[model samples]
Target: MSKYRVLVVDDEEDLCEIIRFALEVEGYSVDVVYSAEEALKMNITDYNLLLLDVMMGEISGFRMAHMIRNDPKTAHTPIVFISAKDTENDRLTAFSLGADDYITKPFSIREMLARVKAIIGRFDSKMKIGLQILSYDKLTINLEKKQVLLEEKEIRFTKKEFEILKLFLENRNRLFTREELLKRIWSDEAFVLSRTIDVNITRIRRKIGRYERNIVTKLGLGYCFEG
Candidate 1:
């Protein structure tokens, strides 16, 4: 099985390192950041799970979690809250924000590891039988394989193009503004212009062949897949 990539976002440097080391020892790929701001700047959609600290400078983990759940690309990623605050209200807030689990501070390493394994395992099982293959008329895409097929013929797409097309296909008939595309597809580290989205969409349409017209442009509303 492939190792799951996990991101730990905490303001405490020592705690982050400890968690990172522990998770890495458990056969998982792990990355640690010291703040929610830093976490948001990176491409977090690639992570299978996120371990977030509830309290931090500027942006609290709860606020970050809200943002993550709102973004289409990262909305489904599993989130776990680790905090010293053990109030019932705190736990409720975490779950309300779509947290998979909440771990109190000074938790046993073994227990934390077990919760991580269980949550990721459950999500993996669900995805194996869920929307892995999406079909819209003659166009089909395998989310797991990142492959696109048109009329049974395979088509090549750049990473960004594939992501954009996947978004369009997943939400057929829903118009997506260029700003929304940039927010969902590109990381904050990159300065992507609206023209960049247009170019990628053009390439996606060209590669799809006969399905080109399925991706329609509204005069002032942005883009959507008519299929």
Candidate 2:
């Protein structure tokens, strides 16, 4: 089997080197980038996990996590934030961004390794499950292929849009609060406003065409897929 690929994004060169050395010793294929921008330029889908620092030049790790979740190819890849920001709000922000774990700075290398192992083990098991295909009204989603078919015609969907649609379809008629949707679809909820959900839902409605009516909005509550 191939070694698990990991990307570490942090502005501190020394820290990056230490992490690279440690993870390499653990038999992982590791890549190190000093800036979030540099990490963005890479094929993020190539890595199974990302170790990100919150304070980085140009783009913060939080922003990087948002970008990753918005990309269909890397949306599901697990993220663990390692930063000095350890406040309750900060940790919540990390979890909202869909991060699997948060490791505050001044952490032990052994602890980091243990957390990484656990997160990877959990996700790997999930990936081993057989293919899943779900259909609602005229829309069909191939979970394994990450493809959507609308009445037999393949439709392109942004990663976030596809995930939103999939969640609604799978839980048909179940109301999903804006907060719930953000938690379910995004890795960094702080960056995604309630309006963002509205925008994605609008786009999804337009893409699915006639099936749009199946998605019902309950005033003062949230949205539900009634089909």
- Error in Å for residue 21 of model 2: 0.7
Off by over 4 Å in 1: 131-226
List candidate 2 segments past 4 Å from native: 130-227
Go through the candidates in order and give each one's C-alpha lDDT. Answer: 0.91, 0.91
**Which 10-residue window of candidate 2 scores lowest in summed lDDT?**
129-138
* Candidate 2 structure quality by residue, lDDT tens digits, 166-185: 89878998999988998989
* Model 1 Cα lDDT, one tens digit per residue, 55-105: 998999999999999999998899999999999999999999999999999
Model 1 clashing residue pairs (backbone): none
- lDDT of candidate 2 at residue 7, scale 0 to 100: 96
What clash pairs does model 2 have? 96-187, 97-187, 97-188, 98-187
Error of 2 at 86 (Å): 0.8
Q: Using TM-score, give the best candidate's number.
A: 1
